[model samples]
Target: MQKDIELSGKLGKKRGNTKSKDCKTKTLILGCVVEKPATVGEIFKRTGFTGTYKSLAGMIRTYHDYGYLYRSGNKPFTYTISELGLEHLENPRLAREALIERRQANAVAVTRRFLLGMDEESRNNFLTEMGIQPVEQHVTIAKNEPAKPDKVTVKVLPEPVEKAKNEIKTNTRTEYVSRPEDLELIRELEEMLASVKEENENMARELAGRTIAKAENSTKKPPKVRNYDELLIRCKDTVVGSSFFNEVPYNLYVVIAELTKASMKELLKEKLDDVLGKKDFKKGRIVLVSDVQASALLRYKFVRKLKEEEYEKIKPKVEFRSDGVYIVVDRLHFADRMCDLPQIQRKSTPIIHHS
Candidate 1:
C-alpha cells in the first residue's frame, strides 16, 4: 500500500523534461581505450563484441556525440575516453545520472509532441490528468461590450434600498424547530442504516478477498527476461505504439520485456494483453521495475524519432567555455532528476597521469 502511494506521488509530480545505452556496455567501451587511444576496429577487437561491427561503430559514434569518447579528425579515427568519460567509468552513479537526464529530456520532448497534437480542452485535460497545472489564460472583454460595475456605490441611497438595508440590519436570525418523529420516519431511518451496514460489510469482504489473492500471487524473486523477438514479434505480432527500434540499448529492451510480461500485469497495474494480445503466463512472476519504467521508455523512444523542429524546442542548451569545452544544461524542472553536483572542469594547464 505504501509502495503504491509512492508510485502515485511519483507519477503525479510535475516535471519539465543520454548518454551510454547501458552501464556495463558503457564501462566496457570506455575501458577499452583508457590506457591508450584505439581505432574503432581495434576497440571492437579488444571488447570481443558479438554484435555486428556497424552497431559497435554506431554506439562509439553516439558516445562521441555525448562527449564521452573523443576521436581524431583524420580518416580511420582513433577513439579515446575523454576526461568526462573517465570520471563516469570510475563512478557508476555518474552514468546513471546521465541516463536519467537523457530520460528526462526525452520526457520533455514527448510531452511537447503530445500537447501540441491536442486541442486546448484536451491538452488541458491531459495536463490535469498528469497533475500539472495548465497555464491560466486571462479573460478578455470585447471592445463593443459595456463594462459592468464590480460593486454598487451611491452617495445618497434610494428610499426602497435604504428601507431594505434597514430591514436587513434589524431582522433577527430564524431558528429551526424540531417536529415530533413519526413511526414510519423512524423505521425508514433504521432501514437506511441497515442497508448502509450491509454495503459496508460487502465492501470489506471484497477488499479482504483481493488482499488474500494478492498475497497468494506475490513472489520474492526478481523477474526473468523473456525473448521478446520469439514471444512478442514472431508469435503474437502487433504494432502497438511505434515501430520496434533496435537502436535503443539492449538493457532497456530487457526492462520493457520484463515489465510488459503477462505475469507482471497485476503488479505493475498495466495490462499489455489488451493491446499486445494475451499469452498464457506463469503465475507469480516477480516484477523488478517500477510502474513508471514503461512510461520512461516510451518517452525515450518518442524523443529519439522527433521531427527536427520538435527536437529543437526541447534540446539541451549547449554552451562553450573560453577554452572551447562545451557544457550541456538540460534545464529539467524536477530536482531529483537534475544533476546538482558541481562538474569538475578540465584545467587549461594539463596534468600528466603517471602509470
Candidate 2:
C-alpha cells in the first residue's frame, strides 16, 4: 500500500500531453529496483504479468542511458537505479522534475552511455570530470510519508442493498466540489521551483573552458592495484595497460596452466579476449609465439571495447600490472607464462604470491 502511493506520485509527475501507457507502467516499477536491483525476468514476474518484458527492458534501457538507472555486467540482474535516483525521491529537484517531464514528453531524445562504459560511480565521476553532470533522475521512496487515514467512508443513499448494488454495478459518477484555492497553491509551488532553477543557473554556469581547465587541473591518481584477488575479479577477461606480456615461453604452457589453474586454451582465449573487440574476442583461438609480445595501442583497443560494450555482459576485466606497466591486459599477454615478467620499473614490487 505504501509502495503504491509512492508509485502514484511518480506516475502523477510524469503525466502530461505526451503521456503513454508504457511510461506510467514504468513508474509502477520503482518498487522492484528500490527494494533491490532485479533482472528482466524478475521484474516481469514481480509485476505478475507477461508479454511486457521487452517494453520494461526498453524503458530500463532509456533510464540507464539517462543515468537514473544502470546495468550490471557479465551476470544476471543488470538493472539498477543510481544513488541520485534514490535522492530524487526525497528532494523534488530540477533534475528529477526534468526526467518526469521527459518521460511525459515522449519527444524521443538520445542519452549518452556511461563513460568508458563502466559502473555507475566510475561513469558518473568520469562525467563529472567532463563537466556534464548527469541530469536524469527519478524518485525512489522517502522515509517520510503521509499518515494513513484512520477510516474511509462511502456515502450511500437510503436504498435497499439490492438496489444500491445494482446502481453501483451500472456505475453512476459523483462530482466533487471544485477548490480553485488549492489548485492555485500548486501552481505557485511549481513556479517557485522553476524560479529557483533560473537563479541557480545564473550563479554557477560552467563553460567548456572552465570544464577543460578543471579536467586538466584535476589529478587522477594512478589507480592503485588492490590485492591480487580483487584485481583478478575486476579484470577477469578484460585487459589493462599493466598486464604481463613478452614473458612466456612456448614449452611452458602446461606449467603456466598449472600456475593460473587454467587450461592452455582458456589461457590463450584470455589473452586474445583482452586484446580484441567482440569480433576479435569471439575469434579467440590464436597461434602462440615463444614469447608474449603485445603493444600499448592494442591495450587501448581493449579499453575502447569496454567503452563500446556499454553495460553489456563482460567478463571481469583482468590485467597483470607490476612496476613494468600500468594496465597489462591479457590481449597484451602473448605467452602463457606472461605473468612471469620481471620488474622493469621498480625493484621493490612484490611477486604474485598469496599465502
- Local accuracy of candidate 2 as per-residue lDDT tens digits, 1-355: 1233222222245455434334444555544566555556456556653344566666667666666655642223245556655664344254647777645433212112223358767765665575543322332221233322431223344367666765653443322322445446545644655565554455446556678877897885222221232433444356432132211111111111121324324444434343222222222322222222122223223211123232122212333444221222234353231222221223366689888
Give lDDT tens digits, candidate 1, residues 234-315. Answer: 2121222112223111111122233344444443343233322322222222111111233433443311132344224433
Candidate 1 residue-wise lDDT at 264: 44
The best candidate by TM-score is 2
TM-score of each: 0.25, 0.28
C-alpha lDDT of all candidate models, in order: 0.44, 0.39
* Ten contiguous residues minimizing lDDT sum, candidate 1: 1-10
Model 2: lDDT of residue 75 = 27
